[model samples]
Target: MTITVILGAQWGDEGKGKLVDGQCQEAQLCARAAGGNNAGHLVRVNGVSYSFHLLPSGLINPTCLNFIGSGVVFHVPSFFSELAELEAKGLSAVHDRILVSDRVNVLLDLHVAVDGLEERELGDAAIGTTRRGIGPCYQTSRARTGIKMTDVFYPDLFEQKVRRLADGYQKRFGELFEYDIEAELARFNEYRETLPKYVVDGVSFMRSAQESNANIVIEGANALMLDADYGSYPFVTSSSTTLAGIIGGLTLNPKNITETVGVVKAYTTRVGAGAFKTEDTEEIGTKLQEIGREWGTSTRRRRRCGWLDLVVVKYSNSINYYTSLNLTKLDVLDTFETIKIAIAYTIGGEELDSYPADLNILNQAEVVYHEMPGWQKPTTNARTYDDLPKEARDYVEYIEKFVGVKIKYIGTGPDRDAMIQRP
Candidate 1:
């Protein structure tokens, strides 16, 4: 395949990292198309666990070259910090392998601070952002007042833009927005001298790779339910998390996209605040959370757990149109006597054809679930698709039937080799 994409079909933290890492072995190029350090992907290989933020998980494969595309909101501190952590884990020649786009927006510490202030202003209505400066940085980008990665190379122009960005926010929050411009500038003064080596024009880079007929893999950030345009309104993340985002963000040709894999979790989960129709605020939610480790990879917050929502999955399929699916964390339901999958959603006793645009309607929407027998057997060590317990297989198969896409990969555990891949 010339190009392959792995994106979360559910809420974020659907274990897209391990799948991306698996595909990386065959990929000559791996790229992150959008979002920022706010998105986290965890990949475990050879007994070492690597968490990806601003960098692509493809770094795990020494033979692969990774790129951070223009659609991403870049942060200097977090980029170096994540790279250093990965290097400490024994990833060699890290500096020589990755390339970043010059058109990307530079996320500053003030952006992070502004994010916190914005959240505070919302009070009980907060969106629960990662406080990583993603939203604020994107806000500036959209406003055309943001500093680009290319701007960092020129101190005078960089300072002018930084002052412009800071002054705008400073006016908005006044005394509440606290920032030390000179200190931040001093740090960038040092960064400018060393950061240019990894910079590249993203379009030219991608064109050259395609010309060479290189196999490219894109690891999407965030998830479908968090997409800005398609997701649950103000509660969603600031960028596109769909297939279109990858194409636009990477400056990629959609026709070259050979395959798109939707990473579907065994159940539904949401971190922070949003309307969760299938949410079980009772014992079931707790058990699923405990067993599934349903915690946010990016935020580390306890996710609100629920049964598998076909309503959500089917809606995701409608948007991204996956070529295949990967049902992850199946073993989390091994101990349940019964398992539930949400089949449809309704409001005021009327069924909706698809996921609604309004959060209010969704919040009031009642979920109709299909209850079935649980496997009650261990699937953690299943050697193959057939090796999985019959009940487990049934659950996976039923999901495949409902979503109208074959489940190609099944994640039994967190290890790189613990997945069962099907033909």
Candidate 2:
């Protein structure tokens, strides 16, 4: 069996954890291919909910082997803290299945400081970053001056490298923002000592697993629309969040991938600042926010709610070549009399079939909506496509037709069993 990639098709918060968990039961190895603690995956098991930032969703399944791939950046303290919490809940065994990749970049205290300072400098123009040090770490990684998990074992070398990087950053800070640096170095060393035990060389391990025909699932953080190469620029993540990212991150061949599942919400939601075309500024948006608990899992900030955008979904499907689609949070729209789906966009009176390359264009684009009657009746009892109300089925079909992607699974609630597989 080859690897399968699972990613979000819309602006994140797409219930990727539930979809990953559902498929992980049959997977031998499950790995997180990209992103850092900036992205969160919320999973519910045995009626208890757990929000994971650095850990793979497969950890909840005992039979599966979980790996944090090299493409991720590790915040050691946060990583161990989550591990301890999961252990306290008896969710995972310590030494048996979990593995950390050696090539994974390490996030230092200085990086966090830089992130805060940069964001503060932006002020009103800030992108509303989580300030978790992800962007800075990736920047340093690209510069080839960043530290990795493998460097932790060599204290003297690591300290020297840190000193050199600190000096350069201090010089830049002094010139740009006039900030002090000695205190930052001291704080970074303190954090360095608190890192937990972890193994390296994740690529080799994954290759071996694949050689053994292990059923592997590569999970991506964020979504295609937030990808650095394809997303809304200046507001995008530093790393690749698309299907192509899996190949480079895990050192896997294209032939190793057999299926790609794109997860999306029934409605659209985004945290922080960006161009949101179908945003609802009315009572329905507020109602959806309350019911969905639409908030950033990492920053705890309220998320901007909007109607589903099929134009972006079509773009996502084309980029990822998604084999299946998982639609979540369908129950959040239960109270609405009518639901709107953005079928296309109009800019300067010109109809647009796909997402615009310019962020400004997206900001000014008018959404062309297709209104459908809402299924006010509860769908919690509906376990199959046949069981769903005609209106609800019609809504799903409309989306399938618009996005050119088939809906394979629908999440009716937060529970694990709430997922309905469409035949």
For 45-98, candidate 2 gives per-residue lDDT tens digits of 788988888888888888998888889888877877888887887875844677
Instruction: Estimate the overall C-alpha local distance difference test score of candidate 1.
Output: 0.91
Clashing pairs in 2: none
Best by lDDT: 1
lDDT of each: 0.91, 0.83
> How badly does each model clash, as a count of residue pairs?
0, 0
> For model 2, what is the alpha-carbon lDDT of residue 192?
56
Tell me the tens digit of each residue's lDDT in model 1 across 1-423: 489999999888889998999999889999999999988899989889998999999999998999999999999988898889999999987878999999999999989989999999999999988898899999999988899998899899999999988898899999999999999999999998889899999999988887787899999999999999998777899999999999999988888889999999898898888888888999999999999887777788899999989998999999999999988888788899999999999888789999999777887788988999998988885769988988888898899999899999999988999889999
Lowest lDDT block of 10, candidate 2: 176-185
391 Cα displacement, candidate 1 (Å): 1.1
